[model samples]
Target chain A: GAGVSQSPSNKVTEKGKDVELRCDPISGHTALYWYRQSLGQGLEFLIYFQGNSAPDKSGLPSDRFSAERTGESVSTLTIQRTQQEDSAVYLCASSLVAGGTQETQYFGPGTRLLVL
Target chain B: AQSVAQPEDQVNVAEGNPLTVKCTYSVSGNPYLFWYVQYPNRGLQFLLKYITGDNLVKGSYGFEAEFNKSQTSFHLKKPSALVSDSALYFCAVRASRLTGGGNKLTFGTGTQLKVEL
Candidate 1:
């Protein structure tokens, strides 16, 4: 079975530019999540999407960070006016269920973003 | 308000010796604990989790974790370490309160495990 997959293994963008990272969750996974790994902040959850419901954006660092998951499949994380501090490994994970103790999130290879 | 802590940034062990990676967590009620390992340039792989019943939970690659409610710790252990086991180890925790983000896991800074021969 194919695990989660993220596009653009590496991206180097200007500090003020916008960047979009894509993720393809495993087939039939109803819950998807985005997280970032950085030297300064370690690992932090960015956002989550569960079948058709309003996405949980509480973990998003700022307004510039947004994500959209359409119909329980693909997800896109966009950072508008990226800052140098946004440089990090953006990871995507998906689980069978929305939220529960039994939910085990499988992670993707991650998209490394370098905001220069 | 749930959080996890890996006290030591790194743990060094001999290939044939016992190894232990410390992990402590703070959460509201009954906590669900998990362990994950990450090789360089790869995503994290789930190792094991503690959700109920027994205090001792076994996981992949001969690894296991013991859950201690009184100590608020879930330490990963292996009887004999392997050189290939060297990698970044993360401890995560989630409270079973069923709040909006309560099920969302909180990970520690991670511990670097080095197994030498």
Candidate 2:
């Protein structure tokens, strides 16, 4: 079975520009999540989606960060007016159920974003 | 508030020696603890988790973790380390309170494990 997949294995965008990163979760996964990993740092939670819409967007660093999942399958994370600090490895994960209690999440390869 | 702490930044050991990676967590309710390993340029892979029952939990690649409620720690261990086992290890925790939002997992800064021959 295919695990989660993220597009644009690597992206280099200029600061102040907008960048969109895509993720395709495994089939039938109802819960999806986004996280960022800076160099020598841990995974930082960003946002989460359940059934095509996000209910917990608290982890988003700022208003400039947003994400949307369509058809409960694919998700897109958009960074508006990217800052140099936004440079990191963006990771996507998904789970079979929306059980926000104790389910394990499967992660994707992640897309590395570099803001020059 | 929920959080996890990996006290050590790195752990070095010989290939045939025992290895241990320590993790401590703070949460409101009964905590669900997990261990994950990440190779360079790859996503994190689930190693093992501690839900309930026995204090000793076994996981992938001959790895295991012992849960100690009194100490508030879950330490990963392996009988013999392998050179290939060198990577970044992370400890995560999620409270079982069933909040309205979702099961948000809190991760530690991660520990780098280096196994030399």
lDDT by residue (B6-99, candidate 2, tens digit) is: 9999999999999999999998768889999999999989999998889999999999999999999999999999999999999998787454
**TM-score, one value per model:** 0.97, 0.95
For candidate 1 chain A, the 10 contiguous residues with the lowest summed lDDT are A97-106
Question: For residues A5-69, could you state the per-residue lDDT of candidate 2 as single tens digits?
Answer: 99989999999999999999999888899999997556888888887454689899999999888
Model 1 fnat? 0.57
Docking class of 1: medium
DockQ leader = 1
Which 10-residue window of candidate 2 chain B scores lowest in summed lDDT? B96-105
- Candidate 2 clashing pairs, residues 3+ apart or interchain: none
Interface RMSD of 2: 1.9
**Residue A81, candidate 2: C-alpha displacement in angstroms:** 0.6
Question: Using TM-score as the measure, which candidate wins?
Answer: 1
